[model samples]
Target: MGPVSSRKQSIVFIGGGPGGYESALVAAQLGADVTVVDRDGLGGAAVLTDCVPSKALIATSDFMSRFKAAGRLGVGFEGTGDDQHAEAHLSAVNRRILTLAKAQSRDIQAQVESVGGRVIQGTGRISGPREVEVTPDDGEARTLKADMVLVSVGCTPRVLPSAMPDGERILTWQQIYDLQELPEHLIVVGSGVTGAELAHAYLGLGCEVTLVSSRDRVLPGEDADAATVIENVFRRRGMKVLNRSRASGARRDGDGVVVSLEDGREVHGSHVLLAVGGIPQTSGLGLEEAGVEVNDGGYIQVDRVSRTAAPGIYAAGDCTGILPLASVAAMQGRTAVAHFLGDHVAPLNLRGVCANIFTDPEIATVGYSQADIESGKADGRIVTLPLSTNPRAKMRNINDGFVKLFARPGSNTVIGGVVVAPQASEMIYPIGVAVQNRLTAEQLASTFSVYPSMSGSIGEAARRLHSLES
Candidate 1:
């Protein structure tokens, strides 16, 4: 930690998610008297329920995937293939998941406190400009004055009125880990990133999985080609994927749950997990009364610098209706703090932000998409190289996925790229740098990558793009 400057300003952050706590730490380091008021535990839903929990389970899912393919890799086990009993010890997994989440929450809390920021475990609402009212869990409400305020109240899962979760047979994504037994047949609704990842995870864990999508394909908002590849992989793994089916309602019947589609079709499973989407948690927080602007959907309206309509009040993260990513939230928080402290700050530019979807063949993309090129919004040429051609993929017996690169039409400067492979999350960083820093395809091609590596495909794709100019 650097030395705190003598200059001091009081800063209050509402919500203890990545955006709120991360910014509070920065504010404290900048010599501000910073305090965070949070309703939930530190680290927010991203840590306690959603992102961290899902990824931990995915790590196990990835191992199971590898275990199933051991025979192809010439790796042998003592038991016969048919006699193998590799059931998931779900109770044990849940215990580990909760342990990891709680540890992370405590770690984040420690980080904030170590940097001199005080944390109040309570619900905070804006009483007025520069004033926050905090209601503690077991105490009377108290008011705190601040020179600046950051509202980062994140979001909660959206549930259809007819399909409310019972927490036993029908569960939200947050409620799944509480179950002591693995779902015999898991029916996952909504084929977005959350639904796809969980469906893949449970399927890899040796359970029967069904994925229902309202759109024509899974991951409807994702890159079309990437979505197609994943949907194919889902079906190939014996997971039932029902596309063009909009779920109207879900109900518990006997020992099972049935999700009814709009067209009158019904899918039955031992359990139903809803991953429809999320609604911003900005309502009834004294926002409207404080004269801060929130949209019809309850998302706080903010400028690129994260300022709200009311003076001295700023907003960030999912609640602001910007890009709903953890990294984006952190950057927004830092930007809000810098601006509040009278320091020079650049407004957020979300164009080059990298996003990854964790599935069997993970999907990672940065900057412009294939849709942008076709729509003429971006004047770029695209080149793709399948991972099957890479020596590492062959050595590993991995035959799926590709690396797609995009370059400007004239100078061939790399503007965007996507990677679909196992651990695509890690492989996408170099391409992210190329896009973020405006590095040209020629520059990427010039870079050296180890032979028999998955990353070699990235350089090769750029090399191919460079060849078009010759």
Candidate 2:
């Protein structure tokens, strides 16, 4: 669609996430007219506010969790040496969070620029069918022509107006870093992954924490047994978990915030973190006017290849209501470009994608789960091996989590696996590869694992399934 007059079949990407920038880079390399317009930095929410920063903070919090068990490992600490040493440790962690956030943002920007893509920092909206109107930095408005428009605007933290984030006492997930000092009595209102994660992070950092959940358990969306383990761990750490509770409002006290529940329960803390959920950043983007199909929940509706109902308009990442992860977003973007350029495009297979909640006793899952199979949602067999019996887990005094594997009944080919323990995110990679390649449990069991290692539990799980099949 290269034009004779003024156009070059422009490909305009309307966000800067893994999805947005990756596609922009690919299309640019393929000689398409590429421009990415975003309101904030090039990396969007994941790099700037959510994933990178949250993971950075989690790094220190993970250390705190390990420190609590150091005594069991014959490691002694003499009360941090002094008060000055304690303060130094806290400040070091805080500074590292900010440093990593900025560095990750810069790296994403550099990736886009290196690929010959134009990055315009502004709020972009669909002005017409093939044009995106952007308000430039200095308040100048410009319309960017597009032969194909890709919306990858990602998501925003959902906030209830009744309990809005003041960014001081009360804060959204994005506002967590603004605290000058550690939160004493950090009350997190929401018991999903985000809520559970922050509550655990603060609790590990020695903050008295309470978790509020409107459901019967934390991580209501996860496997029931996995959620139970996390809840027990939270309680063991002295976290006050208020299940079946809803937050009515929040108010700033003299030095803290008081959260009122619908059942007349009051939880007080130095800070309030609203871990409710996320909503797509779709409003005011001129989506409806351009006839792009949007789901009832306001997410852009697209096929597996990321093509929307509207002609020449595609969406990816969180905006498409697909699996919300930096990795998923990047793949979606690349696939959309492949389809647009008339190249062979494999439809997105979300089954093998791994999603990990970076919390103490981290939860990681790829593909199917035992619960999903038993409930008839999927067809598979489940074999679980407790870590208590694993040699490495016994050596580490770790008796909490287990490796649960799911595979087809007769063939015994691995379909999915879940790991619920420290560093489970990193350990779940082998299961991801096994599922992707349709490897049998017997083959996984045959692979050797280093003796006296946590990863040996993975091979043990596979061996258990092999025994069941025999």
Candidate 3:
């Protein structure tokens, strides 16, 4: 007599990006069998094309920004800031950095495989509510039946017909690596965080950079005051920021591109980097056939816990079209698995998610915003402390930016905050913890910060809120 085969429920995760791979690792640790499929290698677009590579380039720019501003900090420079002949100017080793960034991506792949989960290199789809079909690179077609399936397909750079990336004259953030030499004049289209960060990076790298913003200020999606500080700093750095300017298209003229703006204005440059946003990769994945709902933008609709309309299928990351950040993707993925496991779980809270734009005097915001509070969308009070007034600012030669906190009118609990200054990304973490843990202003104020540190401004802001409470 033959023994009967027993079947155990398996979790099939499609799309091997941050959302898929990270959760796959977590789910496996929780004693669930997981399989991840992707068109590219593991770690997905975030590691291969976006966050990791862009941050590597930004690191070079960060150092350069410091060198350019070093003179103001009482550091000696042999010549004028504009003097090309001067050896004391900011420089870059883009080639070395790009090489190192790629190596780091490979290392991420190694970590993903160590968790005893399977990552199949291929495209995948939801064949049915709880079924996944994978088209592997080896011409093998396999179907995976699972108790739950997670869709984390991620996204791709949005390209306009007018300025197709030629990988030389005009380029997307991903294609910028194809560049052999640093651009002499890089005209960046789009003034959002992506546009502003790259424009600032290129300018710091000694490129004559022009930032094109359709709005009156940079970082239109962020706090107005924060954007204003960055815009002012950009102008002061001679970045040639074109406000209220819209780029119509880009065309190759010989070896360069002349970016045509809406006002018949022409800006010629050695290269053009398109900092426009990305489109989620949801099409042709059999999503329509699987009874999953996709919005006008092609984003899959998911519930608070990342459950799609289809009972057994869930989606996360940029594929869900939530606010785009790698950290958010990871959280959504973990939430989806927790929800599927039938455990006590909470819906993902993006309010505590910190967003940073890596410009000189970086802008970081977390939780609720003053703009929302003032607009009546939220009810809260605000307290702002400019960095210039802080003793640390004077010692560090910091002349721009501030820390602004928002709290409920009566409860005085911090609802949200924004930091616009050097290393604002790092300073916003404590506020993020406070907001996430539902801590009150009094609780945050009680924490002591070292004197002569920028973080003291955060504690000071919390202390002022106590005065308002009294």
Candidate 4:
């Protein structure tokens, strides 16, 4: 920390994603001279290609899924059988996704500019500890002096040498929106969040989907029980899930593609989507020259407050390898700005952060997990209640999900929870609040939840935990 300057502190942000733009707004609002340098449009990859567009496609897929289930709810079309089958128009969906993403980018840019923050559409690099060099697409390169620099360049889809995406038969998640027609038989490689999500979305859209996973189970990084539920749902919905299968490579074969497994087996599909993972975009940013340290995987090293080792330089978002979610990025960005400005700021509490998978039966979790308790990392008791018992779930004919809660053994304080349902993302917030505030299970159970709603299961689980403690 340095002397408090009387004048407005100058801040330069490299990259215009959630981490960059969100911090720019905060820094500007705090009377700092803020400038954001970015190559792509505002909103970065999350808004433009990954999160926003993917979710938009999922929303459409979810609607189609619900429509397909109408016949079970005593709803029928004029014609019977195949005549009533619904189809997803990929062209229209892709067009809408791009349109929505661009509009959001423009909105973010407008908001930043309206707040008196400057945005340069260019590539930004840290030239020194407090200097940024920006090269615009249509203009000459220029250098800007700043009191602080924030690096939030984000990350890119990690490409494997053997299964390189051709943006045609073989595609990365980012290249999926360019598709003019739906894949006939889609082979989704990797069973991580992105792979599981897109695979489920395509399956709901009436495409033949085969999910290939190297791990024994899908969503290997998430809660085990939640993953099992999703896997069961995938199998029930007619998806071919190949576990313990690693894809060696993929190549175009006539009108379709062939994916080779390490076991000398091959799977053919109309298209293959590589959702393997992402690599941090920390290269060519002059980080080493600026004395900013990066890890072996090329992710910028940052403290909980997003400070880099070099003075006046901070890093956040995927580039920091903290958490890849947009919400986490925004929080990290704000924290970095506040810490730099000498304002009140709390170090990031990752345990309280909520994570969600947007499958048909979404899986959302917050705080300590069952794995934590079993591994002796956390001390807590657990109670799980199936959604099949929930009135709302019964009405909706959803039978494949549950709500699990964790509480301290002695105090009965709510430590964590997991929700697997239609809108688990939205439902996880209350549990998140309980975890963040360290509320007791009794407190949570006493809180009012809507009658005949899926959230009631959360209350029931909490009550059960409280009773066991008593």
Candidate 5:
């Protein structure tokens, strides 16, 4: 045999989602022999199926929304009738969405390979603390040895036994892209981010959407003020908002599906999309056998540094049961690799992470939350400004949504904030920066912003909080 290579500390990552691939790339950069085992294609479910595809459809939906409003802005369309009809060819839209997702996956694969990381398309299971068994789709199984192992198996959409996805009328969020035509009467079960987003998108695409919420509001998990605004917006757009209704089961009724609520009410629709949540994909990986601790839901218990109970093994992403954001997964992966490689590392700080809900008027939140203040967990002052009052809002004919800012009482330190408006996803970045850097409200107020802009409201809110301090 030739001379042994110097890079002997091998790192094996099971799953190629944001968490797995990110860690693998980091480990490779740190001079470790890294291998990523992915059963699905490179970018995992987040890119290949869930996040990317949904956002692509949302983009189309957003365009249609703008097009519909263009008429009010002195922009008229040719061959217009009393009822302007615009149908979304879901097949064509879905084809474009998948194409974009697959392209991104290939780009990620190229990036990982360029960094000297090996990616294997196979299902990987931890056979031991430092060994993984990879079963390739077309080839035979093989055992790979590693100095350290990172499990980032991600998760699958949770489906109730009573409402299994038929890939036809009844569908999960993933099965939606396969639909050949737009749903005439789409019934979305669950009022979480996924449900609310798709309901909004379909409604914008001119479909009659009925949103079923087990809770009182559309987005029960989000900021209360933000959820209320989105729920109102949904109703104004002619979408049926059903509250306090829990789906017991979904069954085919004649040519359509009927969602039976726990309260004995049945809602009929051409198609039903289940957005209950996700179940961690941690089983069948020999985790418990190898002394890796898992919770009741099968999610691996991990520390801030992404370390599991077992030494030389770690877990990240949805499998860790941490905040199930793609950004958090990436951070956890990076932290895991940094710790494993003896590099300077810091525990993941979730408080600074920003999350967005993609609706017609998007809802974005960062840092601390109002619940913290109400519960006395955090002492802060809040100021909310309606976007309707902004000059930019008048020009764009965007009347709904608001900007809410929270600051610590004495120091006026900007801790958390919420933005509900068009392009709120893009607008929340500055707040994320301020929260991460611990910038005070005074500092934000002193900063100048462009006149007649939505972002100006953020600065204006900061100014109001600063004046309160004076």
Candidate 6:
């Protein structure tokens, strides 16, 4: 190591997304001079168009869906007979979603500036290993001297040449918020997390939804049991799911869209929402010139500490192709800053990371999965308890979903867990904690969870794992 510089370190972030803004906060707090240059507004696509807006729309859909259960709970709409229906005003909902997203973006910018970090609205590109050139919308270009540069430009919705978005009928998830009316018949192409989530949201919003999945089932990357439950629920709710259908292209019809399948079949719909996937925003960033290595898929290659191949250059978030969750990006950002500052930091343990899909009967998982055990990738014991058996679930009329736990075979230490329930995202936290701390199944079972709560099922599942071990 060379002699330590007496001056404070200067850090430049090339994006304003979760990774950049989050790490800027940490770097500023550590007494480093920080600057964040971004072309999009502060919170980036994840906040402005993707994650926040979609979730806000989903919240409205979920709330509207609850009205269906009111009659079972002895609630009445007085004079509406037994047919009470809730309507989602698309214009109003879209407005609210945009407002919330913009507000959050402003808040994130404020938080960064409050911590002594400078936020610049500009397009950033690496001019050198330690230099970032920024071009603002209306100002002259400027170069920033950075002791450390973090590239986290995030990703964009992938578009296929065969099917193009017109922003009116054919659309990407980011463009849907601009719609003034709900789609009469929405055909969603793709069945991954984003596709499943938006398809269900539209279905809940009373649109005739047709989910097109190329795989044998939806959510192929998630827990199999959870995907089955969601698929069943989608079908039960009148949404049409076409499995093993590969969309070749989509074209405009008279007043609707026609999606052509590879099998010489066509599905007609009022609109088509393409949720195929996202491409990392790594191009045009001069990564090659900076000596930062980008994989063939355009993802920045980084270690667990978020270090790129080039010295003093780090990458995080979707650009890094790590877990695409916002939480994971935030953690990566913090970890990068900590490591750069020579502060105590733990290398990111992906196995302990928790991921959640935002949908009705949401699926959440932490640590190893059942597939890992079955595939002989891990040694564990498993137990599953259905939500139908939980008193709270019964009282709430939630008939579907379950809690599954995994523990070490001999030691009984909690290794992982999967939750398929309404708000499973919230329920997975404790299991995440257990897995992170290597807590035993007995310890998790011994903890006091409120009786008649959905969380109680987690404890029950843990208790049952002990029996499996014996």
Instruction: Give the alpha carbon lDDT tens digit for every residue of 124-208 in model 6.
Output: 8989758889998889998899999998888999988999999999999999999999999999999999999999999989899
- Quote each prediction's TM-score: 0.98, 0.94, 0.93, 0.98, 0.97, 0.98
lDDT of 3 at 318: 94
Collision pairs in model 3 = 38-122
Error of 3 at 114 (Å): 2.0
Cα displacement (angstroms), candidate 5, residue 15, comes to 0.3
Q: For candidate 2, what is the lDDT? A: 0.85
What's the lDDT for all of these models?
A: 0.91, 0.85, 0.83, 0.93, 0.91, 0.92
Query: Which digits, one per residue and each the tens of the lDDT, describe model 2 over residues 322-385?
Result: 8878899999999898788765688999988998988878889999876778789889888777
Candidate 3 on 1-470: residue-level lDDT in tens?
11122343488988878898888877776667788887777777777777777777777777766776777877765666755432212223556655666677566566666767877888887776677888889888888888889999888888878889988788998887767677889999998878888888777777899988898788888899988888888888888988899899999988778999999999999989998888998998887787889999999999889988877888989999997888989889988887777545789887889988888788899998887887898888889999998998898888999999998878998999999888888999999999999888899999988998898998899989989988
Query: Counting only residues 3 or more apart in sequence or on different chains, how many pairs clash (N, Cα, C under 3 Å) in candidate 4?
Result: 0
* Candidate 2 Cα deviation (angstroms), residue 39: 1.2
Model 3 lDDT, full chain set: 0.83
In candidate 6, list every pair of residues with a backbone clash: none
User: Model 5, poorest ten-residue lDDT window?
Assistant: 1-10
Q: How accurate locally is residue 270 in candidate 6, as Cα lDDT from 0 to 100?
A: 100
| TM-score of model 4 (CA atoms) | 0.98
Put the candidates in TM-score order, highest first.
Answer: 4, 6, 1, 5, 2, 3
Superposition-based RMSD of candidate 1 using all C-alpha atoms, in angstroms: 1.7
Please report the TM-score between candidate 3 and the true structure: 0.93
Tens-digit lDDT track for model 5 on 272-375? Answer: 99999999999899899989999999899999999999988999899898998888998999899888778778899998999999998999999889999999
Task: Report how far residue 313 has shifted in candidate 5, in Å.
Answer: 1.0
Worst 10 residues of 4 by lDDT: 1-10
